[model samples]
Target: MVSDKMFTYISRRLSSIKQTPLPFGGLNIITIGDFFQLRPVKGKTAGGLMSTLMISVSTRVMLIRNICTSDGLVNGAMGLGVSLSSIQNGIPIKPIEHTFMFLGHQIVRSQFPLMPSWACTVHKVQGLSLDKAALDLGSTVFEKGMSYVALSRLRSLQGLTIIRLDPYKFECSDEVLEEYSRLRDTLSPHDDV
Candidate 1:
């Protein structure tokens, strides 16, 4: 993850290049994935297990907890929000009434164990197998294997939409290649054979 200090440095660099004021210099920038990434997602709060959730009716959500595993409400399970009750406090920590029906079964709960799953950064989807994904590796990738990590998350190509594919985005580091070559040399068959 990019640290806040590093991000500030990048902003200053961009400002310097554009000859504008400090901090991005109000330059128009396009993100690789979605518009939601225009703003950084909030870090975990006091709960530490979950962040502040925002949802509405018909919103797609992923179960963050194994609240009702037997009924298929395990972690990573996706569902739609059918209803949302009043907020327990001024904050959205816990909803007073929450209900959703999946597989023809209606489940009601006072506290929800759900999170919005429509979009996320590439780093957030590293180990997750998502049903759908959109990748635009056009000059936005900076780390090695970033393309592979993004492309491998989808279950199939049917759910993937590649807005752009820059071949240069799939570069491997020189140190990695050197180590791979050393390993291959060690595994080579003996000449005496």
Candidate 2:
């Protein structure tokens, strides 16, 4: 949620400068997206604490053992951690154990469970419509229409959620912009009516 972080930064900056506040103190916001996907080559990762919080609050089940029964805690089931422990012998190696309740059973495992949700590259999701989507438009958007392609994955405005949407992310090469302007000029208002 780079956009969420940026929005927060802008809000704080404005408040500090103004000395007065706006409605909700300019904190009204909702962010949706997987945080562990591709990050900007030159930008720092955003929302690290928020991502941890989400993992601590998730509801699906994750199974650590490949042979575990698929009743509910499948290989990629998402769930919350019920308990945690650490085993150490003063050898500088300590493995943390996580216990989770899946389908009324407490499953304990030493290895970290794989997260069920994942962030994918835009190319992987192209041509597919998703009920809900979270997009990270960090400092770098390499190709023209990359942002548009990511956004178009959602079937409707209600299904679209954007993260880290800098104004520069919308900029394209001059040739692409010229073509866009031409297409816009060719559209007639009556065509839709």
- On lDDT, the candidate that comes out on top is 1
- The 10-residue segment of model 1 with minimum total lDDT is 31-40
Q: Which digits, one per residue and each the tens of the lDDT, describe model 2 over residues 9-127?
A: 56557656666444123344454653222233342122111123234433333433333443443333334544335323211112235556657888655544444345666754554
Off by over 4 Å in 1: 1-52, 63-77, 84-113, 190-193
TM-scores of the candidates are 0.48, 0.33
Error of 1 at 167 (Å): 2.9
Question: Which lDDT values do the candidates have, in the order given?
Answer: 0.60, 0.49
lDDT of 2: 0.49
